[model samples]
Target: MQNDLMGLDSVLSQISDVRQSVTDMNAISIAPNPLSNGAVGQVSFTDIISNAIRNVDSQGQEASQKMTAVDTGQSDDLVGAMIASQKASLSFTAMVQVRNSVMMAYDDVMKMPV
Candidate 1:
Protein backbone atom coordinates (compact mmCIF):
# COMPACT_ATOMS: atom_id res chain seq x y z
CA MET A 1 0.00 0.00 0.00
CA GLN A 2 3.09 2.25 0.10
CA ASN A 3 3.67 4.66 -2.76
CA ASP A 4 6.17 2.93 -5.02
CA LEU A 5 6.30 5.53 -7.74
CA MET A 6 9.16 3.60 -9.26
CA GLY A 7 7.09 2.68 -12.24
CA LEU A 8 8.79 1.77 -15.53
CA ASP A 9 8.38 5.25 -16.93
CA SER A 10 9.79 6.88 -13.81
CA VAL A 11 12.73 4.49 -13.70
CA LEU A 12 13.46 4.98 -17.39
CA SER A 13 13.27 8.74 -16.99
CA GLN A 14 15.68 8.64 -14.06
CA ILE A 15 18.11 6.53 -16.07
CA SER A 16 17.91 8.94 -18.97
CA ASP A 17 18.41 11.89 -16.66
CA VAL A 18 21.50 10.28 -15.15
CA ARG A 19 22.92 9.42 -18.55
CA GLN A 20 22.37 12.99 -19.77
CA SER A 21 24.00 14.51 -16.74
CA VAL A 22 27.00 12.20 -17.04
CA THR A 23 27.40 13.06 -20.69
CA ASP A 24 27.09 16.77 -19.96
CA MET A 25 29.67 16.68 -17.18
CA ASN A 26 32.04 14.63 -19.32
CA ALA A 27 31.60 17.02 -22.21
CA ILE A 28 32.44 20.00 -20.02
CA SER A 29 35.70 18.39 -18.93
CA ILE A 30 36.64 17.19 -22.41
CA ALA A 31 36.14 20.62 -23.94
CA PRO A 32 39.28 22.63 -24.67
CA ASN A 33 39.61 25.47 -22.20
CA PRO A 34 40.58 28.80 -23.76
CA LEU A 35 42.73 29.62 -20.76
CA SER A 36 44.12 26.16 -20.61
CA ASN A 37 46.55 24.94 -17.99
CA GLY A 38 49.30 22.42 -18.74
CA ALA A 39 47.09 19.78 -17.17
CA VAL A 40 44.20 20.40 -19.53
CA GLY A 41 44.12 16.88 -21.03
CA GLN A 42 44.94 15.16 -17.78
CA VAL A 43 42.23 13.44 -15.78
CA SER A 44 43.37 12.30 -12.37
CA PHE A 45 42.36 8.72 -11.54
CA THR A 46 42.75 9.28 -7.81
CA ASP A 47 40.56 12.37 -7.93
CA ILE A 48 37.83 10.49 -9.75
CA ILE A 49 38.01 7.58 -7.34
CA SER A 50 37.96 9.85 -4.30
CA ASN A 51 35.07 11.84 -5.66
CA ALA A 52 33.09 8.65 -6.27
CA ILE A 53 33.78 7.48 -2.71
CA ARG A 54 32.60 10.81 -1.38
CA ASN A 55 29.42 10.65 -3.44
CA VAL A 56 28.66 7.11 -2.20
CA ASP A 57 29.28 8.21 1.36
CA SER A 58 26.97 11.19 0.95
CA GLN A 59 24.23 9.00 -0.50
CA GLY A 60 24.59 6.57 2.41
CA GLN A 61 24.39 9.45 4.87
CA GLU A 62 21.32 10.89 3.17
CA ALA A 63 19.60 7.50 3.28
CA SER A 64 20.46 7.17 6.97
CA GLN A 65 19.06 10.61 7.67
CA LYS A 66 15.89 9.83 5.80
CA MET A 67 15.39 6.61 7.69
CA THR A 68 16.06 8.41 10.96
CA ALA A 69 13.50 11.03 10.08
CA VAL A 70 10.95 8.35 9.33
CA ASP A 71 11.69 6.48 12.54
CA THR A 72 11.67 9.57 14.79
CA GLY A 73 8.26 10.80 13.65
CA GLN A 74 9.87 13.67 11.79
CA SER A 75 8.78 12.35 8.40
CA ASP A 76 6.12 9.84 7.43
CA ASP A 77 7.38 8.88 3.97
CA LEU A 78 8.48 5.34 4.77
CA VAL A 79 8.51 4.28 1.16
CA GLY A 80 10.75 7.16 0.19
CA ALA A 81 13.17 6.32 2.97
CA MET A 82 13.27 2.69 1.92
CA ILE A 83 13.91 3.68 -1.68
CA ALA A 84 16.74 5.99 -0.71
CA SER A 85 18.33 3.34 1.49
CA GLN A 86 18.05 0.77 -1.28
CA LYS A 87 19.58 3.15 -3.78
CA ALA A 88 22.50 3.79 -1.45
CA SER A 89 22.98 0.07 -0.88
CA LEU A 90 22.91 -0.71 -4.59
CA SER A 91 25.39 2.04 -5.44
CA PHE A 92 27.78 0.86 -2.77
CA THR A 93 27.50 -2.68 -4.05
CA ALA A 94 28.26 -1.58 -7.58
CA MET A 95 31.28 0.36 -6.42
CA VAL A 96 32.60 -2.63 -4.55
CA GLN A 97 32.13 -4.85 -7.60
CA VAL A 98 34.03 -2.39 -9.77
CA ARG A 99 36.81 -2.26 -7.22
CA ASN A 100 37.03 -6.04 -7.20
CA SER A 101 37.18 -6.23 -10.97
CA VAL A 102 39.90 -3.61 -11.12
CA MET A 103 41.92 -5.44 -8.49
CA MET A 104 41.60 -8.71 -10.38
CA ALA A 105 42.77 -7.08 -13.57
CA TYR A 106 45.70 -5.52 -11.77
CA ASP A 107 46.69 -8.84 -10.28
CA ASP A 108 46.48 -10.58 -13.65
CA VAL A 109 48.60 -7.91 -15.27
CA MET A 110 51.19 -8.17 -12.52
CA LYS A 111 51.47 -11.88 -13.07
CA MET A 112 52.18 -11.48 -16.78
CA PRO A 113 55.71 -12.19 -18.10
CA VAL A 114 56.09 -8.62 -19.29
Candidate 2:
Protein backbone atom coordinates (compact mmCIF):
# COMPACT_ATOMS: atom_id res chain seq x y z
CA MET A 1 0.00 0.00 0.00
CA GLN A 2 2.82 2.39 0.82
CA ASN A 3 4.45 1.61 -2.49
CA ASP A 4 1.22 2.37 -4.31
CA LEU A 5 0.90 5.67 -2.53
CA MET A 6 4.46 6.56 -3.38
CA GLY A 7 3.75 5.71 -6.99
CA LEU A 8 0.78 8.00 -6.92
CA ASP A 9 2.83 10.80 -5.47
CA SER A 10 5.43 10.36 -8.14
CA VAL A 11 2.81 10.41 -10.84
CA LEU A 12 1.31 13.60 -9.45
CA SER A 13 4.72 15.22 -9.27
CA GLN A 14 5.39 14.29 -12.89
CA ILE A 15 2.10 15.82 -13.93
CA SER A 16 2.92 19.01 -12.14
CA ASP A 17 6.31 19.08 -13.79
CA VAL A 18 4.79 18.60 -17.22
CA ARG A 19 2.27 21.34 -16.57
CA GLN A 20 4.98 23.72 -15.45
CA SER A 21 7.08 22.91 -18.49
CA VAL A 22 4.19 23.52 -20.83
CA THR A 23 3.40 26.81 -19.12
CA ASP A 24 7.00 27.86 -19.45
CA MET A 25 6.96 27.06 -23.14
CA ASN A 26 3.81 29.09 -23.68
CA ALA A 27 5.19 32.01 -21.73
CA ILE A 28 7.95 32.52 -24.28
CA SER A 29 7.34 35.12 -26.98
CA ILE A 30 9.20 37.42 -29.32
CA ALA A 31 8.35 41.05 -29.87
CA PRO A 32 9.39 43.24 -32.75
CA ASN A 33 10.72 46.71 -32.22
CA PRO A 34 7.90 49.10 -33.01
CA LEU A 35 10.31 51.99 -33.39
CA SER A 36 11.78 50.51 -36.54
CA ASN A 37 9.16 49.27 -38.99
CA GLY A 38 11.29 48.41 -42.03
CA ALA A 39 10.86 44.65 -42.14
CA VAL A 40 9.65 42.24 -44.79
CA GLY A 41 7.76 40.16 -42.22
CA GLN A 42 6.55 41.95 -39.13
CA VAL A 43 5.10 40.40 -35.99
CA SER A 44 1.70 38.83 -36.60
CA PHE A 45 -0.98 36.75 -34.91
CA THR A 46 -0.13 33.75 -37.10
CA ASP A 47 3.45 33.69 -35.83
CA ILE A 48 2.31 33.63 -32.23
CA ILE A 49 -0.19 30.88 -32.93
CA SER A 50 2.41 28.81 -34.76
CA ASN A 51 4.79 29.01 -31.84
CA ALA A 52 2.05 28.11 -29.40
CA ILE A 53 1.08 25.07 -31.46
CA ARG A 54 4.69 23.89 -31.57
CA ASN A 55 4.96 24.22 -27.80
CA VAL A 56 1.74 22.28 -27.29
CA ASP A 57 2.93 19.57 -29.65
CA SER A 58 6.15 19.14 -27.70
CA GLN A 59 4.27 18.97 -24.41
CA GLY A 60 1.98 16.29 -25.84
CA GLN A 61 4.97 14.26 -26.92
CA GLU A 62 6.50 14.51 -23.47
CA ALA A 63 3.25 13.39 -21.87
CA SER A 64 3.15 10.40 -24.20
CA GLN A 65 6.65 9.46 -23.07
CA LYS A 66 5.59 9.59 -19.46
CA MET A 67 2.61 7.34 -20.15
CA THR A 68 4.79 4.88 -22.00
CA ALA A 69 7.23 4.83 -19.13
CA VAL A 70 4.46 4.00 -16.68
CA ASP A 71 3.02 1.27 -18.90
CA THR A 72 6.42 -0.36 -19.23
CA GLY A 73 6.80 -0.47 -15.44
CA GLN A 74 10.12 1.21 -15.93
CA SER A 75 8.81 4.02 -13.78
CA ASP A 76 8.09 2.95 -10.21
CA ASP A 77 5.77 5.90 -9.61
CA LEU A 78 2.32 4.98 -10.87
CA VAL A 79 0.71 7.86 -9.04
CA GLY A 80 2.99 10.35 -10.74
CA ALA A 81 2.19 8.84 -14.10
CA MET A 82 -1.53 9.04 -13.35
CA ILE A 83 -1.26 12.68 -12.41
CA ALA A 84 0.78 13.49 -15.47
CA SER A 85 -1.76 11.73 -17.66
CA GLN A 86 -4.61 13.67 -16.14
CA LYS A 87 -2.80 16.96 -16.56
CA ALA A 88 -2.02 16.16 -20.14
CA SER A 89 -5.65 15.27 -20.75
CA LEU A 90 -6.80 18.55 -19.28
CA SER A 91 -4.33 20.55 -21.35
CA PHE A 92 -5.46 18.82 -24.51
CA THR A 93 -9.08 19.58 -23.68
CA ALA A 94 -8.27 23.23 -23.09
CA MET A 95 -6.43 23.44 -26.40
CA VAL A 96 -9.44 21.92 -28.16
CA GLN A 97 -11.69 24.48 -26.52
CA VAL A 98 -9.43 27.30 -27.67
CA ARG A 99 -9.45 25.97 -31.20
CA ASN A 100 -13.21 25.75 -31.18
CA SER A 101 -13.54 29.30 -29.90
CA VAL A 102 -11.14 30.64 -32.51
CA MET A 103 -13.01 28.91 -35.31
CA MET A 104 -16.31 30.25 -34.05
CA ALA A 105 -14.90 33.74 -33.86
CA TYR A 106 -13.58 33.48 -37.39
CA ASP A 107 -16.94 32.32 -38.65
CA ASP A 108 -18.64 35.18 -36.85
CA VAL A 109 -16.27 37.67 -38.43
CA MET A 110 -17.03 36.22 -41.82
CA LYS A 111 -20.73 36.88 -41.22
CA MET A 112 -20.27 40.40 -39.86
CA PRO A 113 -22.34 43.37 -41.15
CA VAL A 114 -20.47 44.77 -44.11
Strongest candidate by TM-score: 1
| lDDT at position 43, candidate 2 | 55
TM-scores of all predicted structures: 0.65, 0.56
**In angstroms, what RMSD does candidate 2 have relative to the true structure?**
26.6
Tell me the lDDT of candidate 1.
Answer: 0.87
Off by over 4 Å in 1: 1-41
Model 2 residue 103 CA deviation in Å: 1.1
What is the Cα-based lDDT of residue 35 in candidate 2? 68
lDDT of each: 0.87, 0.79
lDDT (C-alpha) at residue 4 in model 2: 100
